[model samples]
Target chain A: MKRRSNSDGKSVKAGRRGTAARKRRPLPTAARKRRHLRTAVRRRTASVGRRERRDQRLARELDDITEQQRATSAVLRLIGGSSGDLQPVFASILASAVRLCDAHTGVINRWDGEALQLIATHNMPPAYVELRKRSPYRPDQHSASGRMLATRAPIHIADLAADKTYLGGNPPTVAAVELAGVRTALAVPMWTEGKLVGSFTVGRLEVRPFTDKQMEIVQDFAAQAVIAVENTRLLTELRQRTDELRRSVGALQRERSNRLMNLEAMAAAISHEVRQPLASIAANCSAALRFLAHDPPNIEEVRAGLNRTVNDSHRASQVFDNIRALFGKADQGRQAVDLNGLARGVLDGLRGEIEDRGIIVELASAPDLPPIIGHRGQLQEVLINLVRNAIEAMDLMTDGRRTLKVRTERSAADKVSVTIEDSGPGIDPSQIKGIFEPFVTTKARGMGLGLALCRMIVERHAGQLSASPAQPRGSIFRVVLPAGRNAATDATG
Target chain B: MNGQPEPQPIVFVIDDDSALREALSSLFRSVGLQAKAFASTSEFLQMNLPEAPTCLVLDVRLPGLSGLDFQSELAKANIDIPIVFMTGHGDIPMTVRAMKAGAVEFLPKPFRDQDMLDAVQAGLDRDRSRRKNASDAAKLKATYDTLTAREQEVMRLVTAGLMNKQIAGKLGVSEITVKVHRGNAMRKMGAKSLAELVRMADALGVRRTMS
Candidate 1:
């Protein structure tokens, strides 16, 4: 309004100058000099007035621009800064809103469907905030802020005492607003893509209405507030997604390494387990060939070599069968397996190994023992692994006393057990408990999975395998399989 | 070529695998190499084997003391036996380590029979040379030990690239006495020349003082 009036005054003065110029030839020199002086005075004042008015307008525009820049940079900083949590960002939004509106108290609300949620506040006394938070805030048209929410516009009240809503209505908000000693307040609606998200509210203690410029400035601050909240929400979500991805990757890495370790163990075990039989096969073959090539052929020795070769080949194949059973043998239906017969078969197959290690075996099985229903191949594997461990244990002894005593008997009326005892150095009492776990090894070249696999096989048969130190020397392994009348079984006994 | 009979050549095999041990013994016997197999090192050490040109086929991964450790132990006990190592699982580093310890061969299992025979033959040859050099030095030392002290001193000087007169001067004896000792020493040592005496002296490790 001031700028338009100033321009109108200049046009009227210009029209008077044009008429004076038209009558200049018909006038005397004195009259002409007076008009020129008067015109000079008028033009001088007009130029000064225009310069002063322009300077005033620029100053006001610069003030408004500076406020907008401050608010914008604050919001941009919140967006770019480290805000893993949005608490600090919320507080900053309220701080800017309160300061920009020149109000003593402020709040930022989040709309969670039918009610307003007060997320953050600045200069709000703890008691006052707690009181307002005691109940849900419904945005109704009865209150000034609610009116703004309904219209998607800013609502400024110069004096709450004169506002109609506060005069006679909704006691809670009016009371809450009054508790803060608020006489005037501004509530600006905040929107994101035309959806009403929340609002920024400011309250003054004095009874003075906010001007149009102050209302506009508060809206700008409200825009900055909405940006900070949305940015914080997106950033938090992204961080959570990244955290979940990293955890899954860590799990995958662990699984892959475990599989690789299991593969390496299988290879080492095959090498340690199968090499002995293969070696004997080669040796026997060479012996047989050499005997046949003799001057007077030693038919007797050659026959014995051929026989041993056959035995060794059979044993080598059995070694592979045992390893295969341990790896991934599909369940070959359980059968009534004679414990004594199985033990004898295993011992017969390992005759070369026992003799090689110079070990003496004492097998004592009670007669008329009931057969247990179990996987024959798997049970043989368990026995082999246990017997092998016993042999290796006795390898430390140089006194030439390597005795393996395997006994089977009815431990109870309903259960039978086989006890394999070694005359090698006894297991340490402390280590007996954990010796059956995977990767628990007593031999340098041994893959510790032998005993662990044995225990797993026994457990799967609804039986128990345990270890104990023998009296004064050696170690004992006992496998107890319940006679099939037990509750966990309905098969052959 | 000497009048004494050459001892028989034998192969000693020490392994914990019984079938392998038995087969190897039969194989060696078929070839007339006189092979003996033992289940363990202790079993081998229990009996006294013949003092013949012999080699040992040792399993590298034995029960108590490993074959490589047994090698160093043999050296410590002053047992001079050449060894050919056999293992079912032999790696490169193990082979290198065995070779470094003077092993004749490191054979991984399932090796060719000829390879075993070759390794045993090489081991036996190595032992033969070692024994020959040792016996020669022993014989020379025994002859040197039988000399009187003065004759021994004169022999030492004579074989040390010194003149007889200088030897006599150092021994504080007359030139004629030095000549008598040198003659007795050469006759007892059976060294027909001064160079032969010098070689015998070197073999016996007989040191003489320089004056």
Candidate 2:
């Protein structure tokens, strides 16, 4: 500073001298021009020196920024390559942070809502690492990490030995000063979603506190650590959800296959039913042909065979018509039906027979039973058939007490049911499965189409018909119909 | 082809369907064979079966018992009869099982007339041969029953390929006595030669009693 001022003083003196010379002697224009040239050269040299100094400072700042960027990119690469494994990522982050901040060693401690768990360490003393290994201990308030937590911000201590905690014999501070030989310490907290998760701490062996730029770099590393932790947690959650979805899809596929199998069985049954009459037709045709080929050509026998063939053909076609009716669209004449009323009407029609058979008819109807949407006539046919079957079943008892139970109730929140129970000889357990099949009848005079047609009509109305052995000695038949659309209620209820 | 008269070969049709049963009966009648139709196995079982060649054309899916079960029931009752199985939908396992149980033919429904006739003919032919063998054995048994105890023993040993001397040692009698007994046994069994007597003993299963 004194040399620059002296130079200024010299220039001022020279200026005054030139003025005095100019006043003293008006003859020296060349000497004055030479003095002007000398002063211009000196000013040019001083400006060049200032420019060089500025350039050098700018280059140093650029180098620092480039190094910090390279370190950050390297840590990011580590996090990406680790693929949810945070151990190597934490280690890489601590190493890069310590190096970029110009510190000697570093430690990354995960705060698990309770205590400091030292997760990763880079170049730390063996004694300090051993001390950290045996613990879920909270750092004393004097330590760098403890202060970082308490303040919820970064802490920079230029000289740990001179801190009041060091004078007060804080164990971690004393340990940092004595065991780790750490003088200057910098600790930055890692935050994720507004919660402090961990701390990134670095210390130098010399009494040089980190620069603001270095503190910023350390904070960046802490943020990167938070991202890696968050990424791992999200990835794990994604995998678990994916597994659950796979299980649900598998269950749905199994259910679909079971339904397909049931459809196949139903088709097989239909084919069997159709084939019976077709076979009879073929046999009758063969018989007629054989009769025509007889030596005497039996004309009467041929006529009989031809007539049977016609009958069988008509029977086969009837089977097809029945199948069509079973699966056909009968939704045109649908209306709201009261099952209890339907049952009562059917019983009224059979009141004389019931009394003759000495059958005690019990009607138990729930007043709140919901109405169902169906073809009223078809549903009444079903009820009548079921009641007649129950009466016939009871009539065969001959000596036992005959009782008929007709019940109606809300089977479910969106369903209504009608049950017919008969006290008679129960169905043989083995023959129960085919009772609803066409041409399979337990009644001696039944054409066997009654129950099958009844079942089809019930199914077309979005209802289910099932049979089970009733209590003691009888059979129970139930028809469950879906309530109309407006009858929906909470399923949980 | 025997010189004696041939009784009519009857084909019994047992099926739950009345139309098919009647059609089958008509078909059999067209060929000049007696045909009887029954709606169930129990109905068929109640009839008096004549002493003639008879074949049963049974539906595989019967109301009371399956045709296969009927086959086993007939076997258990010692009523050996040829069964021609007819089914609306016969799977491979059912066909194989029926065939293994001595079914004459397992004809699926809607079979041609020629096939049904051929199956019934095969069944009748089998039953005819079986009946011929059974009657022949019964006749041989009647003839053999006329022999004395010593002659019967000699006949058994003779059918076992024993020489007269070996027969004498087995019976503890002289060789001359053995020859006498063999000659009388053959005479009673109506055997014209030793080979004929052995055949008669074989028919009566007398060789099996050669203890």
Candidate 3:
């Protein structure tokens, strides 16, 4: 029993020691729970702050993207308004790309079917501009812009220096980017009418690669740039078509007016040349009957009547030949002719009739009158008609105080003028302006074609003919002609 | 018809047209009259009139002076020739002006040959009486020249109804001498009696002045 009691005492002693060990080693659940709660709160707060920052950044980025889209759209609208010159549109696209992408430089490179030409650049150095001008890069296997054009896809370079796939090896564009402290770059094809016409490239100075969001923004702007180019092309095409139509319409109007003037001139020539000879014939016939009634018939008087009839018949034949010449289907023949000489010849031929009618004809010429280049026969016809009309107007003066003054002078640097003034009953003021029109005459027996035919002949020679009432009485007709080269040289001396 | 030779009629033709003038000369010759044509009044003025029977066929409008002016000139000269005026296209005023000037006939141009000839004949007949009277007056004057002044006084007294014895008492002569002067004067003057002598004197217009 004493042994069982000693064992019990030892058990108590061991139990006591075990209780002392339990006290010495307390339970760690509270500290562990506290440590676990503190860790969980710290992790949750950090997660929430990160989420807020991300949302704010996304909102700001979205606003930036919206602003960029609006700016690009506005630039495209401005390009559309400017009717098709590609310079302004290219400038706006390049400048907007630089601003929107926050890049150091931006360039719009045009692939003109054979070569890649830098059309527009924003934020590029002057030295780069000079370098690019000297060594123009062509679109080939060695060009960065060329690959983007050939593939018609987007290209990105995080570090141009480190990148292995740079097609254009250190060209001016790449060099310019390097000088601008740009490492990351993006290139997108610019399309027009579903064809890759050019490329839009954005470069950054730092090694911050373009995110998907930034790439999307750039692509949207690239799309807007392409639309602007296409709009400009259609505008250019419309402008060309309008110009062609205007030219055609103008030519048609000229043809119609020419035809009308020709028809009028033809009719006038026919009537004036035909009726005068017929008048002379009828008068001679009447005078012949009077001579036959003499008691001892005057043979001389009878002979005079017969001679007059024969002369008139010959004159009628000449008029017919002139008509044939006018109507013949022959091309106009151009020649150099002395206008002063022609005027003198016509005046000399008409001098006899003028003297018989008691009219005074005076000719005044410039010291060195110019020769005109034209059809000689046509010019003669014009001068003769004008001179004859002047003579006829003075026919009724009984006291024989009629004067026809023909004067010539140089009018302009390359033009010469001839003026014929007559002292007779002047053209009526109301009829002066329209005298060149057909069928307008003030003569009692006149066919009213003299002036109309004169206008046509003058116009055919590339000259102008016009008439005005003379100072006191009668009319003055002025003709202006382009002087020939020889004539001008002679005139200078 | 009265034992006298038929009077030769003279025709004066005037026309402006030379052809019509020759044609008219031929036409007048075919009718057996002495026809003379003058171009104008000036030509006709220098011409002498025939003593037989003369008729003027003058154009209305002559070169120097008009036909109406010529007619007036003829009247002023106391010419007793009858006029037959011709016209080309006569207006009423011209015709009336010609007829009032004692034209025997006014013939328009292009007239029938018969019409012209008849008009000429009528003018010549009227001119014949005037010429005969003028010639008779000249013959009376020649016969009277041979007589004394006493015989003319006796003729004037007898035609004035004074008897022969009264004429002898007024002139202090014997009745037989007065009767002898009257008988010689009447016979020399180609009068058959005293009344016949008075008739001749009246026809000569001597009796009007004597009375």
Scored by DockQ, the top model is 2
Clashes of each: 2, 0, 7
Q: Write the per-residue lDDT of candidate 3 for residues A1-493, one digit (tens) a residue.
A: 1112121233455466467535533337898687669858966986797578557656765677577768877786787587667777767777776776667778777667876677777777777666766776675654566577778888888887676444345575467555565678898988866777777888887776776656766787778777876787777788899999999999999768766866765654554434444434443444445446656665565576567667766866876676666545323455677777888998998789688767777888787876777767767777877887787667533453689998889899888888999887777798687777654432212222356666776775567898988977888999998889733343333
| Alpha-carbon shift of residue A360 in model 1 (angstroms) | 16
- As for candidate 1, its clashing pairs are A158-A209, A426-A474
- Clash pairs, model 2 backbone: none
Would candidate 2 be rated incorrect, acceptable, medium or high by CAPRI criteria?
A: acceptable
Instruction: Give one digit per residue, the lDDT tens place, for model 2 in A256-369.
Output: 864564355446446556666666777677777777877877789888888888888887777667555544555555677788888899899889979987899999999977
Q: Using alpha carbons, what is the TM-score of model 2?
A: 0.57
**Candidate 3, position A30, lDDT:** 92
Provide the lDDT at A328 for model 1: 66
- The alpha-carbon lDDT assigned to residue B104 of candidate 2 equals 92
Off by over 4 Å in 3: A1-58, A83-88, A163-170, A275-321, A331-493, B1-211
Q: Give candidate 1's fnat, 2 decimals.
A: 0.38
Candidate 1 residue spans exceeding 4 A from truth: A1-55, A74-78, A81-279, A324-394, A397-493, B41-50, B63-80, B155-159, B208-211
Please give me the total number of clashing residue pairs in predicted model 2.
Answer: 0
